[model samples]
Target chain A: MREVEPKLLKPLVAGFQLEKTLTKYIVSQHNFLYCQKAADLDASVGKTTFTLLRQINELQKILNQKIMLYRDRFSEADVYAVYCEHPDYEGLNDGTFVDRIEDMCELSTKCAIKEWNKSQIRNEAKQACFLFRERRKWLEIYKTIHNETKTVWLAQRHH
Target chain B: MSMPTIPPEPHRPNRKEVIIDLLESIALEEIALSHILNAESEKIQAFVGECLNFPTKPSSKEIIKFNKGVTQLLESVVMKEWILLRKLENVLDFEDDCEPHHKKCESRCHCSPCHSCHFPVCKCRCSHKKHKDHDCYPGK
Candidate 1:
C-alpha cells in the first residue's frame, strides 16, 4: 500500500484549519452584532437601531466575502467536515443551517434590545446590565473556541 | 477688534464608516474560523483511516467514501453560515438605492491609478463624477 505523503497531508491539514478559523470568526461576529443590535433597539427606536442594524449588515457582507475566500482556499470536503462538527449544527437541516443561525442571531439581537427597553421603562437596572454582560460572554466564548482550534491545528502540524 | 470664537465641529462618527470597520473585523474572524475547522476535520479523518488500516488496509474507494461523508457535513455548515452573512448584508443596506460601497471601493480605489491618491482624496475626485452618491468613495 502506498503511504500518504507528508506533503499531501500538510496542505490538507492546513486547509481544514483555515475552515475552522473562518467558521468561528463568523459565529462570533454574528453574536456580537446580535448583541449590539439588541442594545441599540432597547436604547432608542429610529437612528440608533438603524445604525446598529446597518453595522450588522456591513459585518454580514464582510462575512460573506470571507466565506467565499475560504471556500476558494480549501476543498468542499474540508468545509463540510467543519460544519458537521460545529455545535450549532445539531437539529439544523443542511439546507437551512445558515439561515437558521442568521435568523436566530438576528432574533436574539432584537430580543435583547426589547428586553433592554423593557428594563429601562420599568427601571430594572440589574436586568438591563445583565444584557450588556451577556453579550460580552458570547464574545469570550468565541475567543476560547478560536484559541483552542488554533492550538489543535498547531499540534497536528508538529506531530 | 475682538475675533469671534468658532465652535468646534461635533465629533459624531460616520455611521457608514463604523459599519465598514465592524464588517472588516467580522470578515477576518470568518476566515480564521474556516481555517481551523477544515484543518481539524482533516486531521481526525486521516488518523481514523490510518488506524483502520492496521489489520487489513481499507480499499481506496472505501476510504474515499468515508472521507466524502465527513467533508460534506463540514461544507454544509460553512455554507449555512455564508448564507446568514449574506442575509444580514441585505438587511443592513441603509441607502436602498446605493450600490455596495465595498465593491465600488475595490474597483475604483484599489487600482494603481487610484492608489496614488489617498482614500479620501480619491473619493473626493470620484464623487464629482456621474457616479451615484453611494458609489462615491468615502471621504476621509
Candidate 2:
C-alpha cells in the first residue's frame, strides 16, 4: 500500500467548514420559514417536510462524521485500501454515495410536490441538491486519489 | 425669476424585483462556481492519471513533478470551494436588504401596503387588472 503523507491527505479532507456555512445561511433559513408557515400547509405536506428535514439532518451528521473520520484515520495509508476497509466509506456494500444522493433527490421532489410552497420547499431542495453534489464531487476526488495511489503502490511493489 | 428646479423622482425599486435580482445573482454565482469546480476536478483527474506513467521507481524529477501536481490540485479545488462559500454568504446577506418590511399577501398579485402612501388599502400601485376596479388607490 502506498502511504501518503498527512499533509497530502489534508486537502482531500478539507472544506468541512462549508457545511456549517450552508446550514447556517441556507438550510436553517428554510427550516425557520417552514416552521413559521407550517400551520397553513396541509397535514400531508407537514409530514413530508418533517421527514425531509429529518433526513437532511441525519445526512448532515453522517457527512460531518465521515469527513472527520477521513481526516483523522487515514493519516498515512493508501486511499483505495482505506476506502475498501473503512465502514463509513464502504457502507456495508451499499451502492456508492451516489445512491444516497438519488434517495435525497427523490425525497426532495416528494416534499416539493406536497408543499408547493416555493419559499419553504425550493430553497431547502436547492441546499440539499448542492450539498449532495458537493459530496459526490468529493467522492470523485477520493476515487481519483485512490486510482493514482494504486498505481504508485504497484510501481513501488515492482521496484 | 429663477425657475424652481424639480428633482428626479427617486427610484423606488419594487421589493419583488430587488429580491429577484439578488436571487438571480446568487444563481449565477453558483453556476460559475460549479463550472470552476468541474474544471478543477478534470484537471486533477488528468494529472493523477498521468502519474500512472511514472517509472517503477520514480526518479527525483518524477517525484518533484508528482508533488507539484498534487499541490496544484489542492490549491485549485480547495481554494475555489472556499471562495464559493464566501460568495454564497455575501449573497445571502443581501437577502435582508431586499426583504419587504411590510407583510405580503399570499397572492400572485404581489401587493403590499405602500409605505409611502400610508393607505390601508393601497396595494403598492400594482398593475394587476384585478385590482384596477378595487376601491383602493395610491394616496386615497
Candidate 3:
C-alpha cells in the first residue's frame, strides 16, 4: 500500500510496462479493470489520488526553487518592503509568531536538550539563548520556592 | 603574638567562569534540541500527508483502515514529543541550582562576530587569558 505510486499505474494499465508492485496495487483497486489510455484514468478514484499527489509535489518543489530565484533578483530593501506589507506581521516581536508553548524552560530542558545532544553540528548563539533563558526561568522559580519555605524550615529545625 | 596560619585555598573559578560554563552548556543543549525537533516534525508531516491520500472514494472499511493508520501515527508522535519534553527537563538539573547573579551589560555581546563573550570587560581572571586580548580566528 505504501509503495503504490499512481503515476506508474498509467503505464501498467496501458500494457506499456508491467511493474509488479504497481500492477498488484492498481489491480487491487477494482478487480484489475484495465485503463484503455491515460484518459480512462479519471474513473478510478485510487489511481487519480496518487497521481495528483506526485504532480502536486513536483509542482511545489519547482515553485519553491523559482521563488528562491525570484528573491535572489531583489535587494534586501525590496524584500523588507514585501515583508512589512503583510497585515498579520505587525512587528518582529514574539507575538509575530504563535507561542503554543507554556513553559519555555521545560521545553528547552527536555526536548531541546535531547535533540541538541544528538545533533552533529550546532548553531552556538541560538543554543546559548535557549540555555540562558531556561536557567533564568529556573532561577526565578527557585527563588520563589526558596523564599516561601526558608522561614518554615528554619523554625522547624530550631524546635 | 604570631597568628595561626590557614593553608592557601585551592584554585577555584569565580562567578564569571560559572556564567561562561553555563552559557556554553546551554548553547550546546539547544543545538542538539533543534535537530531532534526538526527530525520529528519531518516524520510526522510525512505521515499526515500519507493519510491525506484517498484513492477513489474509499469504502467504509478502507476509510476505517486509513483512519487507523493516522490515529496510530498521531498517538506515537504525541508520546514522542512528551518524552522529548521530559528528557529536556531532566537534562537541566535542579540540583545545586543556584548561581550568584551578576548584573553585566549583555549589549556588546551581539555586537562582535567572533562570539568570544564580548560581554563587558570584567576584572575576572579570564581577562588574563591570551585569547581575550588577541583577535580570535573564526573557525576551529
Residue pairs in steric clash, candidate 2? none
Predicted complex 1: DockQ: 0.06
Per-residue lDDT of candidate 1, residues A31-131 (tens digit): 43343343343333222323323333333344335445434444443443343344343222232324423443344444535555443323322332243
Error of 3 at A110 (Å): 41
- Cα lDDT of candidate 1 equals 0.39
- Model 1 spans > 4 angstroms off: A1-159, B1-13, B49-76, B84-88, B95-140
The full ranking of all candidates by lDDT, starting with the best, is 2, 1, 3
C-alpha lDDT of residue B69 in model 2: 50
**Candidate 2 Cα errors over 4 Å, as ranges:** A1-159, B1-15, B48-51, B55-59, B96-140
Once superposed on the true structure, which residue ranges of model 3 sit more than 4 Å away at CA?
Answer: A1-159, B1-55, B94-140
Quality of candidate 2's docking, in CAPRI categories? incorrect
Candidate whose TM-score is highest: 2
Candidate 2 positional error at B65, Å: 3.9
Of candidate 1 chain B, the 10-residue stretch with the lowest lDDT total is B111-120
The TM-score of chain B in candidate 2 is 0.40
Give per-candidate clash totals: 38, 0, 16
